[model samples]
Target chain A: MSELLNTLMQDARVWQGHRHNKTTTPSESTGYQLLDNQLGGIGWPRGALSECLVDQPGIGEIHLLLPLMQRLTGTGKTVFWLNPPHTPYAPALAREGINLDQVVMIQTGDGGDFLWTLENCLRSPVTGLVMAWPGKLATRDIRRLQLASESGSNVCVLFRERRYTDQNSPAALRLELTPGDHQDLKINVIKRRGSWPGQRCSLAMAHRADLAFRETPQVVQGPWHQSRR
Target chain B: MLWLYLHFPHLLLDHIRRDRQDQRPLVIVEGTGQHVLQACPEARNRGVQTGMRLKTAVTLAPELGIVRAQPEQDARILEDQARWLYRYAAHITLVSPDGLLAEIGSLQKLYGGLPAVWQTVEQALDEHRLTAWAATGHTPLAARLIARAGKGECTGDRGHILRTLETMSLATAEFDAKTCTRLQRLGLNTLGEVFALPAPELARRLSPEILAHIQKIRGTRPDPQAPWQPPHSFRQQADFVQEIEHSQGLLFPLQRMLSELEDDLCWRQQDTDSLHLILQHRHEEDTRLRIRTSGPEHRADGFLNLIRLRLEQQPLRAPVVALVLSVKRFIGREAPAGQDLLGKSQDLNEAWHTLISRLQARLGDHALKRLSPQEDHRPERAWSASEVQSKHKPRLTNPEHLPRRPLWLLQGPQPLTEPPTAWFSGPERISGGWWDGERVHRDYYIAQLRSGQLAWVFRDVREGWFIHGWFG
Candidate 1:
């Protein structure tokens, strides 16, 4: 009877580990070398929501997302762009090897309707990633999206924040992007799951011709007070 | 064959001046409903010129009457004249509002050659209380020059035609001042002088353009002209001897025309999506009835059904004198591919045609619109109504950025009542347009709700929370 109990216990442990492995393990990195290195070599968690905050306009926020969009879509995955408050110039995205045709632009006015459409698109098998400009969504709405992402494996949800919101919201990753006076970008990893918290790194904006990340030896401290040392 | 050309100097102003007995010389203004374009010959003689300030014209000739030009009305009148002349010559080209070219080459024998045709055209114009000059030549350009200069008719040999052309002024040749001066310097004052020069020397000394003109007149080169080809689709028309008061009286002729049009479409392997029916009433403006299809189609029975349905729903606004049916949108039959054992291929042509016809019968042609996608990220400006010619499909990006989006977007941005909570998952911030005053600083969030729903929310520094999209 003891031996039978031991066997059953081992089986239960293995099943539990398998079930939680995806949520615990980081599937991919942000692919930024120095930033990834400082943040424990784990990439942005998939099947969860990530929020990016920008201090001002034209500060290389779009340039930063180009690689993430390209990586997801290069594998024949469809990216659904929910109501982007601002119109993105398509030709510029195309120059970065991101197919504008595969990117579907949706314009939903209210947060309630926008959330509903996001759920529907994520449920579909064809959708690989969903990007949206949900400015100050309610806590309940964020929770619902997180649950949906968890249910839909391999689906990534990216939300762009126009301003700072409640810092305590549940998200897999939270990043803040700020512009530097020199032709460089300031990125802060405010939150991450199963990784170091409040890691910050600075990198130069990639040139139009240069798509791959080039390692810059220069490293700067986090501008935000919340960032960890 | 003879061609007639008329230059009505300030025709609109002349008509206005004759009708209004104002002491001031009047000029008909042609502008965007707010300015003057030209003055009448009487006004010009009174020192009023084109592009003169309206106030200045008033100051120069305080008694000058001003009338706004109705170009649309003039064009309609001109079209009617061209249609009447269509009976004389099967091919008629309207060069301008007042000028027409008829391919009377084959009709010459029937009308006693160039001289008789010229007389007939002149008589036709005279009957309408209009004066015009007619000329005949082997080429259209030569004839146009002769008619423009108001020079008398020429016949017999090519040399006689060339001689008649020589008497025309340099302005009649439509040459710019530089070319005219060069021609004068070369001692080539007349058409005959320019025609006598060797082609090579004339090309070198003067511009090749002048040489080409001379060659065109001499018949050494072919005169290029774009002959007007009538639309392939059919339009139905009925001429009534007397005007009819009731809409019922118009239905009989309309039905006949519809049947004829239906037969014509089937014969051409085409379907129509819209029909334009014009009712010409005696001493009244023509009433136009436009029928539109819900989809692509062409069939007589279906078209008739749609027209009958529409007429049943809405009564005519005015008494009908005649009925005319014209198709504006035509869909060509698809080429047949080798079929399977059933000897049939899957095609939507017949189905779409039937569907369109039914829709057209119920709703007029203008009611239906096909939405085509445009290459813009702005939701409100993403699609437009389909035009007659199909446009190229928008180029889609290859590396897709899947952003949560809604299916239907409001035409304009709706005002939000309150700011949204900025609970977010993804740190994807997009900030742009610092150079332009219209700037956006937003930190977009892809948030998940407890109900297993995904929403795209953003936080604006100035404004609070707004939901931009939802993911399904």
Candidate 2:
């Protein structure tokens, strides 16, 4: 029995290593040079679930999704929106280069059905991503979604949390975005796979006069130097 | 002259000869019982005329077939034919079910002469498997009489028109008995006799009506007519060189047509209420699929998204040869203008439009409904879905009550299993709709669940409990 217990502990380490080796697929830069650089020099960490928590309305949540949606839709792939609480402005999204034609919005009655639909969309090869607004989801549910996301190499799922939850989630990345003091925003990285949690970053946010999306984050000062001085 | 008015009324029979079974002396009957409307030329040849007793006609010709005359179908077909004729003549007027009067005055120069225009009309009729006898004169009444006389071989000139009128019988002249008696008293046996009289004397001897008829025959007055106007709707069509069996093949062409329609809507500064897609099959009748919007829209993305959803739900019935997108109704658009930085940040109208477009794209037009506040104090019957119209604005006079009501309400009360928790508040009673069958006696509650999520639930006096909505 002791020998069996010893073998089980060794097997658990192998599983832990597998989970730690979860790396995002190579993705094209989102054209926002500084923002892309901050986001590991890759766009929205492909083939994994990313949570974007926004406290205030119209800060930069929509602007961030615009580039991601545009890239997916531009490649002639389908994007499923599962139970989005707030309505999307079609003209605004169109100006951002996102092919609204490729986006399918599904309004489910409850959170349970919304998650079910997301999983179904992820299973399909034609589907590029599934973004959902589940008011509050449990950690087990997030784990199920993460597993599915890994299996479906072509698809990515995003959950926009309306209210904060205390449960430990298995999301590949958890970002807490809050409205900034001025015409800017603050991004707090809570968790990331195979990497240390990132420091809270502050960057300027400017609206494109002609286009719909927000101009990429421009660093006003280096975080290390500003804090040290 | 024995004017033989051979109205070859069995025109459809000649056209449908290949379908020999339908060629039996067929008469188009309309309505029911005693009111017999019309008979085909074949039935006419068999002595089965219009207004004749149905039983009598049946007994006279046992092999006589019957078809119900659909005036709407005939009108639609005739309208299509008229549109095609516009290519040949600038103005073409539909005189009757089978007759057309085109103004060849201007076309005479283009086609070389009046005879050339007549020949062109003849060729057009031949293409459609129809035969038309035409005549031209100074007056419309004279031209109509000459054409109805079945003088197809005759070239209509001033002298020819005069001779035709001279030989025409009083019955074929379309004059009433009283007018005929007056003409007879004046020793006028033919139209030429009436035309021979001086205009002032003719006016004195008879009424102005008779004089005007004479003038019309003499081409002295303008023959006024109201021309047909096509429906005020936008239509974008793409005919495929080769038939497409797959939906993917249709996407590119459909996108092009949609963009064109989008441009048109933008140019007009209007938004469409509903768009209909007509897929014309290779050999079958066209199939129409309609995409209606919850609210008026001009955005191409919104339109395309709705179309994609519909296509995903229901695929094509058959291979399509052509696709057409037609806008049924257009509403004027009023987009929000740029505001100053110090002013109120929210534009309720723009936000409302965005919400409606999103809902329309997700759920069908029927699914996305807006609760328009009615002029009633009762909470249950306060609002209803806005009906289809040009202008749709919610009459929410009581702004105080709106903040209390949930944005998304259940279509019908959902029956609940159990109730009660620490988070659930007191029941707010609402009982109404006694006149209608749906009488409601419910106590609504704003309940906060154990998970800290808020829900709108209600309890009935008889039917127990129901959960209605959730506050996000």
Candidate 3:
């Protein structure tokens, strides 16, 4: 009976509750101390799928991945961006110390092609990270991506609309982002691999003084504006 | 000076058999479509024989498939067979219409022995599904005569070859009809009977051509052979007996052609990035499909997969009768950097190239792109999307630093109807494009909207506010 139990425990399908804290999968730091602490003392899970849920664009979502991208490209690893919402501005990426030569941008036509490109990138050995904006995905799609990432030993992050917050996923980690006060991003860890859900962490995204909201300039009457006034 | 000759009795018939999948009774008729030139084994099994009239052969085998023979096509097929033989022997001569003469004496040591060389050629013939009669002789003419008689033996012994030649009939000696008839009238039915006569007496009785031919066959005279060289580019065509109705039916013949191309590329130590596939239709214009790879590739599997994907996208419009695969440009193969000679671990660059090729094959060729910065200040012109480079170049450190830019730039600026709640910085003027006649004067600012979205807003000379980008 003990030998049978040991064999059963070796199978990945059997989830043991007591072995939660002894996770052996490697992970990278998320660059936020509070979020890192909430994520079982490690950062983003490596060789696994992670999902980021956001309602709108430009709310510090891309800023959250800058550190990982910089670290990856600095070490001669490739980063793939599949079907991004907008153009990945080159000057901004270069300014962040990210190697543009190591970056590849892929734009696919349909959902099938998007999924195929995503899976290929995740399974490629030379890939450091794969970031995609897969609009909607089924449960099976996410599971396959998770398996591919685990096999390739790379990081894969999928950005989805905030409406998918209630749907269950097989990702290693899931986070929901909303705007916070004073240019801060409110990150709510809805689900984690080895931790309880609903942990909150606020991260400051904008560090440049020129990006903060200041007093509005007074309106000046010019020749072109005279007609409008 | 040992010579080897390969005699293909049914070259066109064998070629047609290789293209199709069925073992049907087939025969190659003369150019006049009157007599049978060659009969396949399936047809011969049914009592249909060569040199028989077309009507007679059709009666003998009612289900026989007849294909009219063309001398031009026969010559081409013979040359293709010689190309295959070039890999085994260095000096190959194309004997037009159905034979190849190769000097294999020098290759005996290279291939270990005469038997080894013969075995190698036999295995290659079997692999290609060809029926050939091979023989070795002291002279080229001797080898040809013995092989044509269907009594060829893979022996390099001078005495054995001479004895075999002497036993051949006068007809198999390949002499002109006039000379053979004259010699037969003189009571010389076999080649040995003619050789027994005095040389001067025979030369006086017959024309000088027969005497010179005999001397050359006996190795007393030199027979110069023009060596055959492989063409610079690969081009081969497969003509079918039955028309292929579906594009899928073309893959069978295409598989053989692609493997041949792979062998050619490997032999040349080169790779190609483009392949042109032409399909000939019976009534319509030829359909052409061009397959392209991101980097140089020489694998047949990769090319076949790309062709499959392309065919799936747009199928044939008519029944195809022939297929032509050709590659014009050849790229010299370079060993991948940082890869060990033993190849214990897969090269990362090769993996990257494979992924890119697979994506491009399924998706269109222009789906993937590389982003590089340009020397321009206009937000729209600040970056460029170009083809991915096969080799990655290291980035240079630019000493000049530019101002802040957004993470995501909109394709086109949208007019801002709602005013921003706060303005952080503004009025950094950019006025340019005057030399290009598309002048632009704008004041850019960082503004915070009511929804807390950081926007890169610009005001034109007309005082119209437009949102240009987002800081994602």
Per-candidate TM equals: 0.33, 0.41, 0.89
- List the candidates ranked by DockQ, beginning with the highest: 3, 2, 1
Best by lDDT: 3
Mark the regions of model 1 whose C-alpha exceeds 4 Å error after superposition.
Answer: A1-229, B1-235, B239-250, B265-273, B282-284, B292-298, B309-314, B327-333, B337-347, B356-402, B406-424, B430-441, B447-454
**Candidate 2: C-alpha RMSD after superposition:** 16.1
What is candidate 3's lDDT per residue for A38-75, written digit by digit as tens? Answer: 88787888899999999877678888898999999988
Compose the digit string of candidate 1's lDDT tens values, residues B1-472.
Answer: 3344444444444333322323456666665534557676667787888887788788788776666656664654455456556657777677765566777677778888767876787786665445456666667788778777776464545567677887776767878889988778866677767777789998888778878887887678886666565445465455443446666666666665666566567666776667887877666797776776544455556666666766775676666655667776778765545545664332323333343344334433433333434554433344454321221246444424424233223344333333222233443566655664556676655433333223345556655555554331
The candidate 3 chain B region of ten consecutive residues with least summed lDDT is B391-400
TM-score of chain A of each: 0.74, 0.74, 0.83
Tens digits of per-residue lDDT, candidate 2, A1-229, equal 9999789867855455434554556454545666665666565655568787765444555555656678877875666666655544333344455554455666666666556556655555556766777776777887887776766654354645536624467776677776554434567777765556774775454342111142332221111111211
Q: Is candidate 1 or candidate 3 better by TM-score?
A: 3
Q: Which window of 10 residues has the lowest lDDT sum in candidate 2 chain A?
A: A220-229
List the candidate 3 regions with Cα displacement exceeding 4 Å: A1-22, A208-229, B31-35, B52-66, B196-205, B340-346, B394-400
- If both were scored by TM-score, which would come out higher, candidate 1 or candidate 2? 2
Q: What's the CA error at residue B330 for candidate 1, in Å?
A: 6.5
**How well does candidate 3 reproduce the true complex, by DockQ?**
0.43
Evaluate residue B464 in candidate 3 and report its C-alpha lDDT on the 0 to 100 scale: 82
Per residue, candidate 2 scores C-alpha lDDT tens digits across B1-472 of 1111113243333322222323466655665645345665667788887788788888877887655455554554455456546667656667555555556666667888766776776786675555546566545566677777865443546666678777887667888999888788877787767777789997887788877876766667656866655456666555543467877676776675677578668766888868898989978888888787656778777778767766765677889876778887888885545555653323433333444444444444543322244544344465454322222333324343332433334555566443323223445677777877767787776543334223457767764567665432
- Local error of candidate 2 at B289, Å? 11
* TM-score, model 3 to reference: 0.89
Which candidate number maximizes DockQ? 3
